[model samples]
Target chain A: MNSFTPDRTSFEARLHKIGDERYHDKHPFHHLLHSGGCTPDQVRAWVINRYYYQSRIPMKDAAFLSRVTDPALRRSWRRRIEDHDGTEDGTGGIHRWLRLAEGVGLDPDYVSSARGVLPATRFAVDAYVRFVRDEPMLPAVASSLTELFAPKIHKDRIAGLLEHYEFANSDTISYFQHRLSEAPKDVAFGLEWVLDHAVTKADQDAAANALIFKTEVLWAQLDALYSAYVSPARIPPGAWQPGEGLLQ
Target chain B: MNSFTPDRTSFEARLHKIGDERYHDKHPFHHLLHSGGCTPDQVRAWVINRYYYQSRIPMKDAAFLSRVTDPALRRSWRRRIEDHDGTEDGTGGIHRWLRLAEGVGLDPDYVSSARGVLPATRFAVDAYVRFVRDEPMLPAVASSLTELFAPKIHKDRIAGLLEHYEFANSDTISYFQHRLSEAPKDVAFGLEWVLDHAVTKADQDAAANALIFKTEVLWAQLDALYSAYVSPARIPPGAWQPGEGLLQ
Candidate 1:
């Protein structure tokens, strides 16, 4: 009996539904952000902590590639690494991240080292990597399907950061600029990979689970940040002190 | 004795020498950049490809932590991660990175995924990670000693990009604005680490080598961008398409 079936919707719709439900819009931080309820210290803390996960996605993709057994899948998936780490000579997403690090008043070297990242952010991003690593290959690839709905979030995020945050700037966020094009391509590839491989009811269930897991991965990071930076005490260790038109 | 030993200049001077002889300043693109010789396409490629590397630095740092066994060292080193990641979750350095992406008029997700980033960029960044992981721990820390010299280069790069690259706005590059303060703190910490840890002649030599290695890692990425995007080709296979007024 096929207990769990792939509810065939436009891949976009399914992914969008995930965002609609779990994308942090309902979180207090979003409310505070859009409503301008956050403190400047909160904003600075937000900027400093998120950089860890920002820096990890590409390398984690590379680690994921190392675990995959299929050559065709490997060939296709390895590009994520190149997208982040760059080629034989350098010049890629990591470098762009350094520029972002600088924008938030971080030293690129310190930022890049991930030495001081929030425990929760590290755990969430680590969970993302571990999810991709431990899951079925189909689901592993499926996890990245988040990109299917990314352009919309990307748009909202850019406008929200620029309009609401004081320390924020569009140029400092250039890492996202290129993602508009890259996400479509990556989603298309990931979608096709999942569709081709996830033919069983079980696979479909796993695929949905992968998406949920990824959502949690992102959600948890945000939750940690909100707890640490957004509210009552701002007690997270190593948080950035705000001043001079910072994230307020 | 292996004779790549550097002379006894002030630590700052030694660091500056690394920048002078091996920094991207010597790269052809910088010359073309400062001389007003690059086409719009060349500038666009530079912006887009570099975005990949800019986004990934902190990940390498995290991975470095994953490998190291010391708790106190990790505790101290962890501060770097917080500086870059910030406390607001994605609103931190990663979010700021997204802003930079938006400034370039690229999609944040696409940029974050680094799908269209250049191959050369990947190579250089990987080299940094590899250098950290492959070398002795002190040199690995020393490799990051490059931060000491960054304030000057960052200032120069900002001035040059603003002056020579018409596509950029000061706001677009706000990531650097924050770095002016952050880099010095980090450099002080790193320099202190190296001076204290480089307890032997070989250790000092490795520190020097680390600085050289870091400088080359950055310079090579620029070189690759120059060759692929500037003048002759306009756009290379999988390189970014040049757009007007999108200087990064």
Candidate 2:
């Protein structure tokens, strides 16, 4: 077995390198969405499919929180659930995502129901939840490092959608705005925790791979969307169609 | 709360209805594979991806086994792990699946490594494992009721593969043949346990939904295969490509 352990700086660099190479922001579908190339129907499909990811984030965090035996770790992690689920009704990221769905002309109920999400999206999001639930604490924390790369994409998305689409507005895009502040705090703690915990080369490698796995999870969702809603349009049986589940 | 509890017979019928409506045997990809409409590469993809599902079966059972407090239940369930993992090396359903993989011209190591399987396949299979691990004992056992509908599909698969493909000899098809007897024994216990325990209306509904969830897990795998390898052929970024991992 190789035992070449890197210092903290190098290990952090490796983690960031994974995000640089593998993040979903680089996907062609994101390119289209950010550059104003996707149609309204395409945008709706993105919202519908992406809602699956948004809704599952709290579940993933909750699963992670359930596994933490340390009160300090649990305390730090429980905020994620709070951020996504909020303190009361009609608050938090999930509800905000539903607002985004409604702004894009989908029914909030349909988006929340997730009845029309792509199977690939569902599978990918569920995989993330399962990963956090099943993997060791260090690697599970490492996976959340995707948030380290999230703010830039959220900024790009806000700017792009606002410039390109009539439905885009401050109210509709509040989820991304909220995430901009929330993700940095989460990732700062998560990255420091991973760095502190992953002292060995094997731990570092596992942490790096966990981040890659998360990027793949995010990337695969977009790949499914682009395939189903874009050119050639071979939507699988029982995915959302263009006209289905739209707000009147 | 409404107290509309279906009796055992009706509940059994409801479970059968989920299978009738949502089973992957009803999927078009299965139709193609069974009837020899799949190209060799497609068959290879099926073998490669399906091997991930096969290899994880023992792990899923093991997770379930870990949570069982009843010795009799554990004894019955332990057989499932043994059946899939085998008494020693060069045995078990996993090994049999590898034989099928080799028969399909894939490298057994590659198939077992699962390095080249679809993300969706990985996700769906992992979801099943986590479901068994995390859900209540009743719902967890209820999910395995997919086996109740499995024997006939195995019989059909064995006959169809034997009739259609040159690689479909007795050894390669042994997995399904063994499953023909094993699934019935497993499901008999599972179904009876579920029927006995699920007394209230809510319990019955949860049990029925658990079965539906299992069917969805099975159906979604085929859906991923069909979308990636069939029709428009938008194979995701890192999935197994034809001729990528085949044996010499």
Candidate 3:
């Protein structure tokens, strides 16, 4: 190991520190969403954009898996795709997310079609898939360490939604409910994989930077959402307009 | 040709119509920018983020070039890389953009480093590169059709900057000055290439969508800028903050 390399515990702490400081949970959009301060349109917009992220998660994992030479790593990563895409359609995290969309009064088909996703949201999410597709595996795996922060958000989302919104029933929020279990199991493996592989100081920094990039990916989506739907709402052309894509 | 294929004149009009409606020139951000209504900080933010797009132009061209199987096409495309990167340092469109950054009081080195660009800016710009790298050559070439709209925006920008901002000058605004000529030259070739090749209705649709996608790429950068620096400005966590990267 290099002289600059942090001890494993310290490195792990550094990774968690990135999450504490930079994760989307800290974004105001989430604050609004969780506190019942969001209008129904705000919630619907979240559903539409967040669905874009959730939809891309499996593709990113698959991209990561495609580059993995080791059978063990590939096998481990395959579960992530399965988690989001499910064994069949109408299941998995994505379908459950559509359930949430339906609960929020959006047309599930419209959300699924992704016709209304903001340009920024698409760019941010697509960048994640490209990052995994092209980066060296170390940073790529480290990117998933944002999963390190996901469980708490999932828990908070579940509780917050149930308490605040009429749309927050078990069926509606099942995506978060499932993620509450799914993310922890996934993050344990990812965190261990990153900590074990990030032995050099350079490697550690790349890992941390990748995680930071992931946080930005999450954070930028909310920024787009907030700017487009929340305050001084200047919806970009061709993005979801209020009153479009509703379940009739 | 297919039954739905429009005559060449009509097809060309369709492409121009896309620009008429969907081009970044129509974005309010450009309206504010061209009118010189932006605060210095807003101008600086524009410099930082717009630099990311300008910086990537050669790479996107190179990515496009790499996939071109024809020698004639490759030779024609080579000029784009030269236009941005120049034959030597301290030359080319990018360096001229840096001059504008310097004129606006930002450190040239800081703008070049791209450390503080918004995540959305990076994503949108990188998406353009990836689109060129991965898409079929027809849509890939078609994506460059937004240059059709560029000459006018460049003309407006030159006039607007000169009229409204102290930073505007021959040296500082040389990028747009050059583009006023360069864009017409480039877009003439790109528009012809797309029009000649998009013979079928589906091909025309793909080409049109590609152009639309390119417009979004351009517009999203402004949307990000507007969100980050304009009304209800909520800068994302890692983007360029107003006071960072200023020249002494």
Q: Each candidate: fraction of true contacts kept?
A: 0.00, 0.00, 0.00
For each of the candidates, the C-alpha root-mean-square deviation to the true structure, in angstroms, is 16.6, 19.2, 19.7
Q: Candidate 2, residues A1-248: lDDT per residue as tens digits?
A: 24589899988998888989999999999999998999999999999998888777765765665455333454466567668766566777888988999898898888777887899998998899889878999889999999999999999999999998899999999999999999999999999999999988889989999999999999999989989999677898999988989888
Model 3 lDDT per residue over A1-248, tens place: 86788999999999999999999999999999899899999999999988888777765765565455333454456567657766554767888988889898999889978889999999999899889878999999999989888888888888899999998998998888888888988999988999999999999999999999999999999999999998879999999999999999
Candidate 2 lDDT for residue A134: 86
By TM-score, the best candidate is 2
Tell me the tens digit of each residue's lDDT in model 2 across B40-155.
Answer: 99999899889888777766775675455333355467567657766556777878988998998989888877888899998998899889888898899999999988887888
Q: After superposition, how far is residue A53 of candidate 3 from its true place, in Å?
A: 0.8
lDDT of each: 0.65, 0.84, 0.85
TM for candidate 2 is 0.54
lDDT of 1 by residue, A92-205 (tens): 666676666567666666655666567888888878877765666777887887787678766766677778766567667677777777789888988877777666677777
Residue A207 local lDDT, model 3: 97
Best by lDDT: 3
The reply for model 3, stretches above 4 Å from the true place, is: B1-248
Docking class of 3: incorrect
Q: Give the poorly placed runs of model 2, Cα more than 4 Å off.
A: A1-3, B1-133, B137-248
Q: Write the per-residue lDDT of candidate 3 for residues B133-173, one digit (tens) a residue.
A: 78998999999989888888888999999999998999999
